[model samples]
Target: MSFIRGKKVGGVIYYSEVENVRVNGKVVQKHIRYIGRDKDNPDHIPIEKVHFGYIATRLMQGDLSPSELFGMIEKIGSHVNRENLERIGLFYDFKKNSFSLSLYRKRLSGNQKDAEDVKKG
Candidate 1:
């Protein structure tokens, strides 16, 4: 299962997604995705807002379970209201207690590309 991990470097904390995988008959942690820096720091570089599509994609790929995804969302301080979910081609199924992508994926206007730049720096 994937979960958020924080590593400190040069007195700054950087967070990312990581999971355990079997490698050469040994279980090891593999880096999944770079999330962002500690938001509480003054020098923190803000990354793009987490969208419903990202969560849905990860969920569908089995990278994150429902509870893990929700925990990550809560840790990141993201808002997951119904209107916001529909805006990004996602919806929460109350019956199934899970999130699913909609037929039409609506792209939002924002600094979606900024996260890549931040990761590079």
Candidate 2:
């Protein structure tokens, strides 16, 4: 399973995706992806306000289905449109009433190399 976790470095809190994987007989939390910095911090990086990591984590864990996730988004009144969703690797198909994850587009603005590494793995 995957979840969002925050780690503090140099007085700033950065968030990332962590997944529990069993290696050789022990379970360990592996770093899946870097999400973003805490916006509440003074040195926070100016990224989009959308909680992409949280949403993606929930979706990947089957905590919520795609349509249900969108419903929650609509309730929150976030300005997350198709383009923003695509940027985070979520593709919604209206005709099929489903969505897909595009690993290529999932990484944030500057994590191209990490995304490639995830693909290779």
Model 1 lowest lDDT segment of ten: 39-48
Root-mean-square deviation (CA) per prediction? 13.6, 14.7
Q: Which digits, one per residue and each the tens of the lDDT, describe model 2 over residues 15-86?
A: 877899999999999975454553221111112225555676686887877567556655655323332233
Model 2 compared with the native: what TM-score?
A: 0.33
- What lDDT score belongs to each candidate, Candidate 1 first? 0.52, 0.53
Please write out the lDDT profile of model 1 over residues 1-121, one tens digit for every residue.
9987889999868787789999999999997555555322211112232455567568678787645754655566653332222222355546545443322223444575475457668
**Winning model by TM-score:** 1
Candidate 1: which pairs clash?
none
Error of 2 at 61 (Å): 38
Estimate candidate 1's alpha-carbon lDDT, on a 0 to 1 scale. Answer: 0.52
